[model samples]
Target: MDDVVQAQTGTPPVRGAEIAVDGLAKHYGSLKAVDEFAINIRSGEFLALLGPSGSGKSTILMMLAGFEVPTAGRILIDGVDCTRLPPQKRNIGMVFQHYSLFPHMTVADNVAFPLKMRGVGRTERRRRAAEALKVVRLDGYGARMPSQLSGGQRQRVALARAIVYEPRLLLMDEPLSALDKNLREEMQLEIKRLHHELGITVVFVTHDQGEALTMADRVAILRGGKLQQLSPARELYERPANLFAAGFIGEMNMIPAQWDGAALTLGTGERMVPPTGAVVGTVGQGAVTLAIRPERLTVCDPVTPDALQATLREVVYAGAGTLLIAALPDGTEIRARVASASLPPALTEGETIGLSCPPEAMLVYGEEAAA
Candidate 1:
């Protein structure tokens, strides 16, 4: 990729393009797939568009790749408008969920296919294909067919093919969704390394929270085709902007409560000090929802002073800790995580237990949190 990238003495050049999307929307008749979506992605930054099914994550990706046209708004790459640019002319590479390798072509020929489209000579295509294969660590496997390689290897070939031309941007639409747990994780690191080495801007799409949090420099969360929150993974996890974000990012126990800014009254009518936690979202008055992480809660005897009372419904032993599932008086079930060694051996289902959390471990949201 000599012509593709300029090597620095000791650092990677930012060969990626900065992108801007403003008022981007897509509509299929009455169905709005994306609504006023906007974001700014810096050069060489790895950004993940994360959301559940039908949340417009893929819609935005396709628009960026020029495979889908927007009903409204504009896309700018490197300060130039590309909203109407053809996919082939955009110089954007994409790797899909399925490894779309050519079954009839050898690995070398598949990698060289893009170059051939641009009318490169046969000799030069062969040389470039060999170099691309080496970068993906498939140097000698180039002679093999796609059917002969494992799923991971085929995916690697697809990646090499995408980066072989060193496009300014790389778009991945859940590329590891087909792999098993172990291999998916392995590929995450592999892709991250490649992004660092190649310095290419990447817009990754995934519904898996772990994958988004683990690999992205920042994550843009979406729901029902609208952007919910965009922030660094840690900020998104620890300082969620709203109830939906607080509940979606990870496992959270939302409890019904009443708050007056200084104190909180539980659903069971027990009064306690309000959460002194770092507040990130709107904390409303009257009926409210108190949110806490399962890992931050402690399970104890019902007689424990100041602890909320609950009936143990089940116990789950995870590798690092035990999960305590309990229900409050109103039948609202919640979870708590405790070190396995600390669990009371005599505790059983139907036994009354106490749940407590430090003031700083909670956040208060409106009653809509229950919905």
Candidate 2:
């Protein structure tokens, strides 16, 4: 934990100089792009802003990076009001999905641009450029142009350029989206390693849940221009704030229901007790929504009396797992994934089976159960 924070500490430590966005709001004509956005980013924390497209995740990032101006609210970095600060004066580093490297310059020249702009001597600039390249593990490729490298390598060069000057905060926008899956995963690890090595505060924005989960020390989820939840990966996964968050962050089976204090009784007469201390709204008595991840559900072969009966709808081989689609007796469809090696025996469409889910794995929400 110390190592994590140390690696993200800026070149000149800004002690207690955290970022605070208070009551941030932005609009475009009649559409509210961001509303009442607020987040406190610690000086050396690796934080991620995650949401679906058009969910205003990137807009908030742009606002923080000085690319977009908020219509309302204030932004403070290290307790300094920087809401109106120009991008160049912010002393922030940024990289984006497009690999915004200088196509005309060699990798070394590109990396040295920031140091040179900051008036470093020629020798020191070249030395820092070499070190940055080495940090990205691309030392010998300094002579290559952006076109000479693969997508991942080009992004690394972009990263090196962003960090060569050791800015106080680093912003990345979908930096790995252009790479192939394997390369993306490799670069994700590399970014995490670099973040650990540099200790520069990072504000990462991405729509990829896996990327957010793998990299961020904490994640802030956005939806409809509002923050839905901000928490550690495990907490966000285990306890989403609402139906939108629960459904968006991962695969879930949402069932409609009527809340009766302790248990939710479905229209089909099925009842589910939530995990202890789970918060279900008071207005949820008439109608409520319940969510359960696919992996938490099990198929019972012997047709147990209490198990919900479902008909196997489809089976798909998903490399590491077999995905099964089942519909309950009342036409409620649910998806579940069983380990591929443990694929059920010859289950076919239309075969009736029973399924069971532990109470602890269920999540209930919404005013009326969602169908």
Candidate 3:
């Protein structure tokens, strides 16, 4: 608990609270912003609510923080119903994408405001403020005004203020979205370190897949106000439940195919076998979509058996690897990522090639699944 201030006298350490959201729903007139949302977040775990804009992730966060009332359902924290509680009474900390620091206040004053609101003594407030600043790696900058700090520093200040009161749960709404690439990556590590040291249950909301995958213990993906899938990062990437989950979590190439229970037939009359334990919805589905990640494809000789024939169309040079764009016999584009050093020297544009994809690496979804 390095990030937490030591107990004073007889005070006990703060423990994280478990959160359970059951049938949570929000409606604005006829608009259903969030519907039938449910998940149980374990104590001391980091969970990410991931989705694109208008997917209702932000609305869910607002409801959880008690800033918005749900149209139906309930929220329980550590077995206590808090669905109707005010934000101040919930005892939860929140950090927003924009650092919502008081520009008129010094860093220390900003961090101490929460304690002051609770009517703590001045001396105790200052001591806890200093300790919180130290936890955020800004020990000597307490006297500086918010305007004097950089973006990342200001965000850290906001984080310090949110946690200074020792809240058992923390909610971050895309807190790193405003930072540059390098700084965002740096803060992600810092947030992870703080979560480990504080043992606070954190619920992070973001639209960036990379950020969610990098920092979350588990990720819940939402689309159109509905949960697409909830799983660890690796499982979400390798085994998406539907077409939207497959397309949203990472880059995927969807190929239209016909399914006949035992095998799939491509438009080019090529018969393909499904991977063992493939998640094809029922045995008798007619039209299906085959999903294969670019990284799962391998380029082979044109004459290779049991391989899809393609014509190399373009070579994209990325520093660490190369992206090969090819066209199948039916004109469907296929993409393959290969290490730069592993690319064949003789491969060139407009040359015939064979693409091999293991059945186990492929995902099949029904054609009617939401995109």
Candidate 4:
């Protein structure tokens, strides 16, 4: 923040805090909501906790916010134990999926609510509130009540209130889920810009993979209360740790097969040689799954060398790309995503065609890793 803004708000620039969650586990009777979850959040980093329903992402976030205490483990914020700290004392700004603004309060008053709670005088509160509203690009809209604003504007007000206190860390729970598609995308960029300007450590929770990929520095993938993988978005998509992660992040084609150390025998008894280190183990032989990304598979002529023959089942036209669904001799289906402009004109439904995925692009995984 610039000196002028800091002077007006009478608050120092916010510095992001590092958080270490060690052996964190939350249990509810017989159910383990979060199991042995551990991760180090870097200072000023935007980290996303992502998972499907019942995956314990919300449980972890609640534990971090002091709304729910863990059954086991510790939460350290900047090396200080905050496991039992009350929500009020944690100095963490939180924005929920719902715009939890007070309908009776004007935007400015809402933004200044935190300062009022801290016992700042009326004049100072107004000054800080105005600056906060300006920071959210609501400049002169502070006098309007929450009911009078659009959904996007209300979300902006919620964000304004979150940062108004100059909290060291920010926690967001799917804050954009309430908006329309375009508005949701717009708010994503807005939050990104705000994070850049404030440089506060942000812990975001969402089930949307696109949001996690677009907004976060690192993504934590969770399932059945256990962490599946945590990595940057690209690596998580390109080199997933297991079959569960590979199938979860995006479109993945999984083929059941038998591996004999050097080659694979598909369900149809077709033989194929895969690159070295295809599977991750010393045994290197057993029931395996050959996984390939839709974009990595190519549709080609039946005469092509090393091609897997299939009958084109359907053609799905997606803007900027086409999804080709093909059925193998054994009736196993696989899809290929190709550029719309690069697709062959002769390709059509029921056309006998050849599909080829390079040996290196095929990801081999043992069957036991299935979700």
Candidate 5:
């Protein structure tokens, strides 16, 4: 984690190929699919628009790709207003969840489709397609038909086609959703590698938390068609802006609490201060919420100082780790994770236990009405 922070210090400034969007809004028959959305995308950076269905993540991507018109606001790429630009004119490559490859065309021909549309000569198109395939590690599979290739290979072909023209911006709409878990992880790394090796600005859209966290340099989280938070992956994970962000980013132990001027008192009568309490100020007494990640909570014998007593409700083994759902004396549930090797042997359910985490690990947020 220290290395992760140090790596941030060396991050390059926003490149010139930046994207500027302001007050972008879209609607359909009074349904606000995208509402006053705005974000600045750094050039050569891998940014992900992450949210569940109907959260307008894809709408934002479509607007940026010039497929959907925004009813309000403006879009600028490299300081040039592209609000009225056509899809093809935007020079943005798009890859969707579906392969969208031509069944009749071989991999080479499919990769060459964009080049041919751009009026490149057959010889040059073939050469460029070959180069693009090499970039995706599909060099020799050029002549193979889509039917002959596996799902992952077909997706690689789609990726190769998208990059064949060397577009300045790349737009992906859940491109790896159709693949199995193992293949999806492989492609996530591949896409990340491509983004770095090509230095192309990418605006990836996905609802998968793990996918967004693993591949994106920055994640833009949306809810109800509005931006909730935008920040680097670790920051968003460890310091979510609100309850929605806390629950969406990862597995969290959300417990009711009340905040005093100096500290937040959990339902279990345990008090903890946020990592950045100074920035958020001391939340005064009243309803509030404390967010803690499962892995942040510590479970052990001898109830360390500052630990809240709890009862071990159950322990579920998850191969790499064990998830313990425990209940505090006050009836507040907290989740804790321990390495599989460190899990207690034959621990009985409903056993009295203690759960504790460093004060800095706590995230406090004001409660909000259910949406």
Candidate 6:
């Protein structure tokens, strides 16, 4: 595949084109499917559009792919306005959740379909088709029909077909959602590798936070037809912009508190300081939500200052760690994940425990934050 692409295009196969979406929006009557969504996708960057259902991630993707026209705004590919172009004229490729391979076509023919439509010569199409199959590690399976392949292999075929033309941009809409957990994980790595090898700008949409965090160079989180935040996985996880972003990315223990200049006062009379140099412009206005991740907390003897006293209500033993769910003196519940080796051997439900975390590990957000 690399050889064929290089031979024909006179450029390395692993480079990508840039894309920009400006104030993109879609409307269904009075309902806004996507509103004022905008972002720049760097060349060769893998970006994920992540959000819950009806958040407009898919609607934005559809607009970009030309499947759905934006009610307003424009889409640019490598600085060219492609907003009004048809899907085929955009020189973009797409893969859907359902592996849309034609059951009647053999694998090679399936991959060659796009080239055939584009008027490539028969000889070149066959060569490129075979090379594409090999690129996906499906070299000798070209003669096999779609029904003869596994779900994952069929998806690879779909991918091969999408990429055989070496599209400048690739749009994948929940392509891995159909597979079981293990296979889904396996394909995640495969897709990541393919992105690196091909260097094609990719815009992927999914509701799975884990997938977005694991695969994307940057993730754009959306809700209520608005973008909540766009950042790298680590930053999005460790320093979320607001309460909604904090709670949506991963499991967080959100405790209601009142912020003073130096610290937060929990309802139970416990004072917790924010990490040094942490921004708190919104913390002083009114009530705030102090967010802490489960792994950042430690369960210990109730003798330390800055620790909250709680009663363990449940102990969940995950394979790698134990999760302790506890209720604070004010009746607020919190969770902590302790490694199996460090958990107290005799820990029991209803036992008193102290939960502590460094002040720097806390995220404070204003009360009016919305999803």
TM-score between model 1 and native: 0.94
- Where model 1 places Cα greater than 4 Å from the true spot, the runs are 3-11, 275-278, 367-371
Work out the TM-score per prediction.
0.94, 0.92, 0.95, 0.94, 0.91, 0.96
lDDT of 2 by residue, 1-371 (tens): 12223444544333323799999999999999999999899877999999989889888989888999999999998778889898888878899989877889999999999888889998988888887788788979988888989988898999989988777788999988889999999999999888777667898999999899999999998888989889998888888777777888889888777777778787678776667656534344567777889998777863675566788889888888888898876788988877887766678888887778877787777653121
Q: Which of 5 and 6 is ahead in TM-score?
A: 6
Error of 1 at 88 (Å): 1.1
lDDT of 6 by residue, 1-371 (tens): 55435633555656677999999999999999999999999998999999999999999999999999999999999999999899999989899999989899999999999999999999989988998887777989989999999989999999999999988789999999999999899999988978876778899999999999999999999998999999999998898877788889889998888877677789898776677756433555557887889999997788778787999999999878999999989999999998988887798899899988887887777766643
TM accuracy, model 6: 0.96
lDDT of 6 at 25: 92
- lDDT per residue for candidate 5 within 178-254, as digits (tens), equals 99999999999999877776777899999999999999999999998999999999988888877788888889887
Residue 207 lDDT, candidate 6, scale 0-100: 93
Off by over 4 Å in 6: 1-12, 279-281
lDDT of 5: 0.83
The clash tally of candidate 6 reads 0
Q: Model 1's lDDT to the true fold?
A: 0.87
Error of 2 at 287 (Å): 0.7
Scored by CA lDDT, what does every candidate get? 0.87, 0.82, 0.88, 0.88, 0.83, 0.88
Residues 1-371 of candidate 1: C-alpha lDDT, one tens digit per residue: 66333432335555788999999999999999999999999999999999989999999999999999999999999998999998999988899999889999999999999989988899988888887777677889989999999888999999988877768899999999999999899899988877877788999999999999999999999998898899999988877777888889999998887888778888788887764564445666787877889988897767888787999999888877999999998888889999998877777899899997876777777764433
* Candidate 3 lDDT by residue in tens digits, 180-257: 999899899999988877888999999999999999999999987888889999998998877888889888988888
User: For every model in order, what is the number of clashing pairs?
Assistant: 0, 11, 0, 0, 0, 0
Query: Model 2 Cα displacement at 220 (Å)?
Result: 1.2
Candidate 5 residue pairs in clash (backbone atoms < 3 Å): none
Best by lDDT: 3
Candidate 2 TM-score over all chains jointly: 0.92
**Over 4 Å off, model 5:** 1-16, 269-282, 368-371
Pitting candidate 1 against candidate 4, the one with the higher lDDT is: 4
